[model samples]
Target: MRGKSSIEVSAKLKHSFLFPDEYLDWANETENNFYVESPLIYEVAFYNGIKALKPWETIEYIPVVLTEWKKVKLEIESKFEKRDAKGATLPMRVGIGLFLELLFWTNGQPVELNPIIPLESLKIKPVNITERFAFILARPNLFHSYKQLAELMVEMEKLYVKSIIVRK
Candidate 1:
């Protein structure tokens, strides 16, 4: 087995197009990928023409958040144990690598975040914002090819850009 398969991440992400009104409902059970389109889910969330949805930017899929399952309390062998024994699911928040599909060179520099902030900064915060999130900037068509996808990932790594903050 690999090292990560054995490790457990505590928290996971649940993305939304717009931040939800009730933080309570933020953790809906059903899948919330924008491609799913459930009011809450959003596919390609943009910010500014450049910042939120930059052109030629590529992103790597990273596990940034953990969807923590509700902890189950149990007793075994005369000892109390709390384990990931019940239904627990979450999204691993991801950081994207940036690059231009058209322009091969002129790789942009990353804004060094000395201490990264969980709350992603947006040019304009959605009307009702709560949790912050991110996404890729390419059109869906580009993802079809392995070579194109690989190029995106490679450039995404070089740029070191963060994802967008989505709301339900």
Candidate 2:
């Protein structure tokens, strides 16, 4: 069914992504049940048990607080650090670099990714519509959830920057 097609699409298009295959698979699996019209578009069906229902309101939820989100981010980063000797960090750095490049290319802004510097030393770069469009075009299956995760991380970084400014 829908899940099978989605998995096939994800696997076929995996080359464009900088993320690990397993991580990308985890991100793509959640979206399997939804209908995909094309690589860039998908339809989500909602049911009321009795019958299918038209979508009404989609509730926006930010269940994780800033602290909790940061903790999760740190845990991921720690795992990367531990596996750095095994080449874990390269994919992460490449993923982050690709995201930053997309941001820069879309916004016509300059960005630099120095491997020698700590990730914290890098500036926060917010994603925009044009860049998102490019991402969807490249990997539509990953667009929804992955973009949300990236945006949340960007927002968290912005909040951290603001906190430092306020503290000073």
Candidate 3:
């Protein structure tokens, strides 16, 4: 996405995403390419099944975009996001979503909220391996962790570059 041209095209983006929520009895369908003001745990419903989801109480957001499948990597732990009063964006730390291959294959189905399910249950496989994961959460501590992780990634990339130059 960062390098691709606007005119360039690839496999069309998957319009529908599966949101998995144990609270939901089943999956439901609407027009493709919809977003909720808040996060709804769902599957790529076009495939997962159909149902209604609990109304979001804390955040108002929509699915941002069906992205190329590479950026969505996750790790497990208490997550956080920084916000200001009224829950708006602020300079913040972010925690990581623990991603596993097992979670990726969950039929993007909903599971009852239980301690056993330690990972996100569903994923939207819009393009490549990385599916679009729209998370509407209300944690602040995780954000700082994410900030640190992001910084680590930057450093890794720089080292990778330096190594390439040395090799040359």
TM-score of each: 0.19, 0.27, 0.25
Q: For candidate 3, lDDT tens digit of each residue in 41-89?
A: 3332322343334222111111121110113222212112223222322
lDDT of each: 0.21, 0.34, 0.27
CA error at residue 129 for candidate 2, angstroms: 10
Query: Please, what are the lDDT tens digits per residue for candidate 1 over residues 10-103?
Result: 1121223122221322222222221111221111222111112222133221211111100110111112123221211111011111111111
lDDT of 2 at 13: 23
Give the poorly placed runs of model 2, Cα more than 4 Å off.
1-6, 10-15, 18-59, 62-72, 80-168
Which predicted model would earn the best lDDT? Answer: 2
Whose lDDT is higher: candidate 2's or candidate 3's?
2
For model 1, give the 10-residue run with minimal summed lDDT. Answer: 65-74
In the range 20-109, model 2's lDDT, one tens digit per residue, is 342222133434322211111111111111122211111111121233345444544555456442343333333343343333322223
Clashing pairs in 2: none
> Once superposed on the true structure, which residue ranges of model 3 sit more than 4 Å away at CA?
1-33, 41-113, 120-139, 148-168
